[model samples]
Target chain A: MARVFMKGTEAIAEAAVRTGCRFFAGYPITPQNEIPEYFSRRLPEVGGVFVQGESEVASVSMVYGAASGGTRSMTSSSSPGISLKSEGISYCAAARIPMVYVNVSRGGPGVGSIQPAQMDYLQATKASGNGGFRMRVFAPASVQEAVDMTYKAFDVADQYRRPVLILIDGVVGTMMEPVELPPMKSDEEVAAMKEAKKAWTLTGHKLDYAHRAWIQPGNWSTKVMQSDSEEDAALYKSWQKEAEAEEFMLDDAEVVLTGYGISARIGKSAVKILRAEGIKAGLIRAKTVYPFPYEAYDHINYKKVKGILDIEMSIPALFVEDVQVAVKDRAPISTCLCSGGNIMTREAVLTAARKIMEAK
Target chain B: MELIYSRTKTIQEDKVSGFCPGCMHGTVMKLIGEVIDELGIIEKTACVLGIGCCGLQMDYMAYDNATAPHGRACAVATGLKRTNPDTLVFTYQGDGDLASIGLAETMSAANRGENITVIFINNGIYGMTGGQMAPTTLVGMKASTAPFGRNAKDHGYPMHMCEILNQLTAPAYLVRTSCNNPQNVMKTKNAIKKAFKNQLEGKGFSMVEIVTSCPTNWGLDPLKCLDYIEEKMLPEYPLGVIRDR
Candidate 1:
C-alpha cells in the first residue's frame, strides 16, 4: 500500500508480475536493461518465465509464442532493438496475439546515442510492423504512471488482441521515483484470469467449452462459415467501443493543451503557470495513442475550446498528427516538437498554446 | 514411410514447391514431421524456418511454425525456446541461412546452450531466390552467382558449420549427415530425430546438418543433384558426428 522508490523500468517490471504476467522475453539494451534484469531475478520466484533473448527479433517472437500459449507475455527494448522486433510485432498483429512491448525510447537513426529521445513515437503507434493493426501506446509521465501503465498494458493488449507499448524515454526508464505497486492477485485469481484468457488463446489443448477458431488466407469457404462463436465475436466488438483517451480539466478552458507521457507532466506544470497568468488553458492527456481517444475531443465544450496545443518529445511531430486527427472538425491544434531527447519545457508549451490562442 | 516422424504438418497450406525438384526440403520437412509425431511434441512445439528455400517450410508445416528472414532462424528459435521453455522447439535452416546472414544467431544460440534443436539443411547454394554463392558452397563448385565456381582465394573456403559449432561446449550434439541417397536419408532422419530428442531429454542445444541438394540451383536434374551432393558436398562438408557432449 505504501509507495517505494524504484527506477521507472524496474517499477514496470515489478508491476507486470503483480498484474499476472508470467512470461517475459527481452534483449538487453541501455536505459531499460533494468526491466529485464529485475524480471530475470523476480520471474522465476513466481514460476514465470524470463528469457534474455539472443536478439530483439527472437525476443518479440518469444513473446508472440508465449502470448499465443495463453501466457501473459512481454518484451522491452530501445530504438534499434525495437526496430528489429517490428517483424514479430507484425506477425503478432496478424495473428491477433495479445502481448506488451516496452520501448524505452533512445536517440536513434541507427544505433545513435543512447541518452533519450521521443523519435520512436511514430514507430510505436504507427509502423510497429506491416499491417493496419493499431498498437496501444501508453505515454507515462512519471515513474508512478510508468508502473501503473505496465499493469494496464496487459489488460489492454488482451482486450484488443494486439500489442500494447509503454513508451518511456531514457530519462523515465532510468529515473528513480516513488511508485506504489498494484495489488497482487491471489493464486486463484491469477489462475482464473489465465483460464479466462485461454478462451481466445491457441493453447495446445482445449476444454469442451472452448472451440478453435482457425484463421487462414484464401480460404473462402472458411471465411464464409466464420467459426468464431457469437459470444467471443461480441467480446471482440465491445473492446473496439471502449477505446478512448483520458481528457483532464478542459470543461470551460479556452485553449486545451494536449500531451502524453513526459510531455504531459510538463503540460500540467505549464497549465498551472498559464492559469496563474489568468490564461484559461487546461490539459487533455492522451492515455492511449491508438484508438487515439477521439471521444475526448467530442466531450470538450467546443464553443470555449478555441485551440489545442500538442507538446511532445519527437522529431517528425508524430503524436501531434494523432492529435490533429482526433481534433479534426472539432478544434484547431498546434504543436511544439522536442527532438532527440530535448525535453519540452513548461514555458515552451505554454508559449505555444498562448500563440495558438492569440492567433485564433 | 515416415522419415523423421512429426505428428502434424503446420505448413500444408502452400502447394507450390519453392525448393528445386528432389531438393531435401520436402524430405527434411517430412523428417521433422516424423520427429514431431514420434516425440508427440507437435501440439506444443514451435518451429522456426530460416529464409532461402527452407524458409517457406512453415507454409507446409502444420504446427505453430514461423519464418525468419535469412540466417535468422536460430535467433528466432532462441526466442521461441526461451519464452516457451515448456514446449519443444527447433529451427529449419539451410546453409546460407545458418552460416551466412544468421551465423551470429546460430553460433550464439549454440554457445548459450539454448535448449532447442537446429535442423540445418546444407544445400551448398542459396536455393529460394535461385542459386547464389553460399557460405557452405564447396570450393571449385559452380553456382549461378559464383559463375566461375567458388574460389577459396576470393570467397574463402566453405565453412564447416557443424565442425565450427561443435567447438562450442554448450551444444549437446552436433551431427552432419547427407540426404542425397537413401542410406544418407536414413542417417539424416536419425540425426534429426536424435537432435530433437536431445532437447526432449533436457539436453542443451543440438544441431543436425543434413548435406542436401538444390537441383535447380546446381544446374542439374533431381538425380544429378543427389549425385552431386553424394560425390561433392559430402566429401567437403563431411558426414559424421562432430560433437556429442
Candidate 2:
C-alpha cells in the first residue's frame, strides 16, 4: 500500500480495522479522542459496530463482552480514563478474553495534565489492575511503529487469549507521519478468524450443557482458583522468550542509554550527537516493555561501559527499576527525568549522557 | 405413561438448583428458561449475568453465558447485542447489581434503546453477601447495613426500577411482577415472555423487574417470606406493566 499521512491515534484505529476488528467501545479522553472518532466513521463502512460508552468503565466492559463472543474488539483512553478502565481490563484478563486497548498516555496521578508524558510505564507493564496478570505491552516510538504494532497485536492477543496494550505518549498520538497501512482483511478471512475460536467462544450452543460456553472471571472453588493461578504463572514465565528490544550501536560503547517510546526516540538522537562529539554512546530501546528485554542488557560491554543513563518523562523514574534489574549493577546508573506533561528533549538526554561519561 | 409437565430443556438436566431455599431466583430462572424454550431461541440466545446470586445462573443454564463485572451486565449486553444483532441477548441482574452500582449502565442502555431484554430481580436486600441494604430496600426495612431501618433522611427511599425506566422514552416495555403466589407467578412468567418477545420483535430495551422474596436475607421462613412480599414488598413495588410502548 502507498504511504499515507495519518495521526497516530487514527492510524492505530485503521490498523485494528484492517486486522478484522469489528467492534469498538470507548469514551472520549484527551490525546485519544481521535481513536473513537475515527472508528465511529470508519467502522460502519466496514460492517463493524462502534459504541461510545457511557463511561470508561462501561466502554472496557463492552470490549470485554464483544471479545467473549470471539469478535475482534478494542477500546482506547488516556491516563485518567485508563484508570477507570482498569476494572474491566482486570476482568478481561481474568476471563482470558482476547482484546486490544491503547493508552495514548498523558500526565497522571489524578488528572495531572493533558500533555504528553511517559508516566504510565509501571501501570502498563506491572499492576494494570487488581490481579497480578501480565500482558505483552508494546511501546511504539513513531506513527509507523504504532501502526505496525497495532496490526500485529490482535493476532498475539488471540494466540494467548489475553489482552494486549499499546503504550504511546501524547506526542505520538497527535503527531502526523506517513505510514504504509496493512492490507484490509477480507470479510471471509474475518469470518474464518472468528471460526477458529468457535471451540471456546460464546457464540451459541443448542442446549447442550457439555458444549455450552461459559465465560466466568472467577472460580468459586479454591482448588480451581489455585490451579488457574498456577497455570497463569507458567504462562507469564513463558513470555520471557518473547521479550524484544532494539540494540542501537551497543557493540562497544562507553555510555549506554536506555528508554522506551518517545523517550527512546529522543535518546537515539542524543546518542548520535554524543558520538559526533567524540563520545562512545549507544541506545537500547525496549519494544515490549512487559518482558523488559532483560537479555538486551547483556550486549552492553560492561568493561568499556562507564555508566548507564535512563531517560524518561516521569519523575521518580519508574522504568529505571526494570533497567536496574536488567543491568544488575554492572555499572552505575543515572536518570534524566521530566514530568507534569513535560516532553523529554535530545539536549537533556545529551547533557545527562555527557555527565555520566564525565563522572568517571 | 402420559407426559404431563416437564422441565424446560434450557435448564441443564444434571444441575441442581444452587439458589437459597425460599429465594425467588430459581422461580425467575425457570420462567426465563421456559420463555427461551417457548421462543425456540436456545440456539442463538446469550445471557450476560451480573455478579451476586444472579450470577449463579451460569452454572444452571445450558446456553451461551458470560458473567460481567459487578454492575456492568447491561453494558456487556449492549456490546454483545450490537455486534451480533442476530443473536438474542439479555442481562440477568439483581437490585444491587441493577439499581445501585449499575444504574448508569442500565439507564444508558435503556436510553439508547438497545434491542436487549433485562431480567431484573428486586429482592429488597442483597442475598449473596448476607442481608445488606440495597437501593430497592423499602423504608423501615432492616438490613445489615441499615440496622436502624432504612431512614429516608439518610438511606433515602426505595428505588422503583420499572417506574424509573418508564420515565425514559426509549424503553419499549417496562413491567414489575412477582412470584409471591401461583397467580402472580403466572403473571410474572407472562411478563417475562413479553419482554423477551419484545426483543425478538426488535423493540428496544424491554425490562421485567420481579419483586421477589429473599427469605434467608429477610430472616423469615419460606412461607412468611411470601406474606412479606405481599405486605411489605408489593406496596412499595406494585405489579403490572408500567409501559408497553
Candidate 1 DockQ, CA atoms: 0.24
**What C-alpha lDDT, on a 0 to 100 scale, does residue B79 get in candidate 1?**
53
For all predictions, the C-alpha RMSD in Å is 4.6, 0.9
| Cα lDDT, all candidates | 0.76, 0.92
In model 1, how large is the Cα lDDT of residue A99?
86
Best by lDDT: 2
Interface DockQ of each model: 0.24, 0.84
List, residue by residue over A1-360, the lDDT tens digit for candidate 1.
997999999899999999988889888888788989999999999888887777887677668766765678889999999999988787776656788989998877788778878888788776787654566677787899888888888988887677787888887888899888999967687677767865444433321212332312112245443553343355544555556555666787888888777777788888888888888888888766654676777767888887888877776777787777777768777788777656677778877878877783
Model 1 misplacement above 4 A: A187-240, A329-332, A355-360, B1-20, B33-46, B55-64, B68-70, B83-86
* Residue A56, model 2: Cα distance from true site in angstroms: 0.2
TM-scores, chain B, all models: 0.92, 0.98
TM-score of each: 0.86, 0.99
